[model samples]
Target: MKTISWGIIGCGDVNEIKSGPAFNKINGSVLSAVMRRDKEKAADYARRHQVPSFYGDAQDLINDPGINAVYVATPPGPHEEYTIASLTAGKPVYVEKPMSLDAESCRRMAAAAAQTGTKLTVAHYRRALPMFRKVKTLLNEIGDVSLVTIRFFQPKASALVANSEENWRVDPAISGGGLFHDMAPHHIDLMLYFFGEPLSIHGHSANQAKMNRADDIVMGQLVFPGEVFCTGAWCFNVPKEFASDECEIIGSLGKIVFPFHGNEVSLHTGGEVAVHRFEHPQHIQQPMIAEVVRYFSGEAAENPCPAEAGIKVLTIIDRFTGK
Candidate 1:
């Protein structure tokens, strides 16, 4: 097995804990280098993380002969640019979620991957997580899944938003829209992963708070092929008392309930309810990273989360935001 030397672009807050260190922790993977537009900060990150090298230019990192795979951790705006560049360089890519600023960009990125025959995976890492896999198993207990309700409410400047100018989540030009664009990819992807493709999509977005440039409220509905329907409501400017992150899947026999951001799942069947609790890995992305490494090594037959799947998600977002 060959080591997959990873060069990460946009070593920002997301990498501070959620993913950065996992490269070396996983066998057959190494964090060889990193890149950021700010050369001084790039070197600082390199030194603190003990990375061998750092660069101000993404191309410098991508062209590094030692790097075999690239992790594009930048905002969605540049996802297509870096992904295509890496694939063109004959290197695979593991891009962060919300694949691009919009569905069209996602299509272009997927096209590049197809043209180059290079691997491209999205960081919908939740699909490979144990809790969600258990949720998938528990779904079987729900006789005939019919409806899913998703609710994610937060006050202004929620902890998840990462208070910084680099807060790309709410910047429409960079993240495509507001909190909905930033967070919905995970829920939407998991929905498709669990229930399959939708037959129709409907949604609307509004900026009720007008606190920022992006929309604060978004409501969406999706009807899947199996008569499964999902309705989602996301509000980022809710009251402090009303903050909640929950999703419920209902079926004829029973129902399953869990938080999209939490680690507990509740199964309601028969006359009783059972709760399953899980602890996230120190690096939650490590499991998916491992699978990507195997796929990169040619030991795994397929990438864990392909561009097609991520693009499907982006398409759904387009419909939701009415873009």
Candidate 2:
């Protein structure tokens, strides 16, 4: 309660840098334990990270009395289960994005948190990142924002080539869908943060490349309050040179341009453009984790990304993918 002693479930590649080490780096927080299905890997991670404990079973980590918090770093399929378990065990939970396999699962997790009176936050870390924060400020300066567009085009990464069933990101049963499900939460959550609740959403998806069961392309249009409109397109089968990641927000007087995965922010008005850049931290999730720690420590009332915000995003994806 005074400090966050954390246990991580499914500490894999994402945990290796994006989030795992952040628990230790943040003040009033410590990475007390980690769990992975592979005991050797779990032990190795504990050793390398100097964590005091590690477990091959998730329940053991969840049950650890020393761990006051749990981070669900597993794939979407298991997120709901572990998050429910952690909440039931009377520990606060920080779950990865895309919250769960579907909106229903997200709903169940939210219910569990409510029942247990435990805090639950989603790792929509972009909400706390500097680049996105700058974009938000620019949106305000641009006057009454009326339109927004999100575009992500990338060639198929080698890892998404369906090398094995173990590559769960492309496996619908495990990942909820494909890379869009994996990556779109950041953009979608940012939209929610910046624009408030969506008035309506219309979406379509297709597996253009036939790379996997999940869609390789998705497009959506969302209408928000104040007659604000937004459109987004994500395509994973583009040529290498054609690859791009950008979001443009236009208002009556000017526009703001930035990328969800990049650091540059461009502001345009009066026929002039200004560009600003930011470098991400080595442990990219640290800033957000620090905020979560502060929330858990009772120094802050609001979670940076609460379970409700995460559920809204999954609902949007579910509406698009029809799942």
Candidate 3:
């Protein structure tokens, strides 16, 4: 793992820009290979990305001698399988968010990493992004936090989902739920990062639209250790004009406000308001990928987003969905 040669499994839309190019952009990292069930598509992606090789099977990519680390970018359905295999083969791994199908599967991946003594990191990439990092830093200025509320109302006609011939994001069997399953991980992970683990989680979900296979609305609350509370609502059937995305952190002194997907933060304190704005990176996940490379190359001490943290997120999601 001297130079951190990488192998990627699954070529989803996220890989196209968010992560794939980042491997090559980092100092000690290289995108050595890629894999997809369709060999033609895999080769095409490799060619387009200037990767050295591609494979039709994930196992082949994992076993490739040129690759020292593996990135599992596939849907959650096969995350556990590929992650366990990569670890068993003595390869470090960076698995996508929502870690796996559920908390149990994440635990299995973590157990395999422990038994095999291999490194595994989860792609809660926001944990390393600039805007979100600023949000965490600003939490100190807000004084003792009391309550945080999140509202993400996306119109069904314009849901922000990955493009694909088969829409697995709304397929409960493969994605574990609907658009909420696809997007909630980032916000939920941020809450945990800001406020530690929760003592209890409670919520519910429903397919209010009846036009989709999975739930179109989800609402939940988290009880943080210091009695800090967080409640969120995610709705996909809202009218296009009513669609909104915002998070408000109310505190003893002042409060902070921001959107989960946007790059602006507003702070209110002492009867004054200040705002901060950031430009999105060409590769939004590059910051996290840089850290992951360091971790895999032994320059860093620990996993950036470990499986243990991922399990907590899955737990909250399950509680909210009543799984």
lDDT scores in order: 0.92, 0.90, 0.92
- Predicted candidate 1 versus true structure: per-residue lDDT over 1-323, tens digit per residue: 38899999999878988899999998889999999999998999999999999999999999999999999999888999999999999999999998998889999999999999999999999999999999999998998999999999999968766554566677899999988888889999999999998999999989898888999998999999789999999999988899999999999999999998889999999899999999999899999999999999898998799998888998998888889
- Show where candidate 3 strays beyond 4 Å: none
User: Model 2 RMSD to the real structure?
Assistant: 1.9
Question: Which residue pairs clash within candidate 1?
Answer: none
Q: What global local distance difference test value does model 2 have? A: 0.90
**TM values, all candidates:** 0.98, 0.97, 0.98
Which residue pairs in candidate 2 collide? none
**1 or 2: which has the higher lDDT?**
1
Q: How accurate is candidate 1 locally (lDDT)?
A: 0.92
lDDT of 2 by residue, 229-289 (tens): 9999999999888888899999988999998887899999889999999999999899999
Task: Report, for all candidates in order, the number of backbone clashes.
Answer: 0, 0, 0
Q: For model 3, how does the per-residue alpha-carbon lDDT over 1-323 read when each residue is reduced to its tens digit?
A: 67999999998677998889999999999999999999999999999999999999999998899988999999989999999999999999999998998899899999999999999999999989889989999999988999999999999866466677688989988998888899999999999999999998999999988987899999999999889999999999999999899999999999999998888999999999999999978999999999999999999997889898999999999999989
Candidate ordering by lDDT (highest first): 3, 1, 2
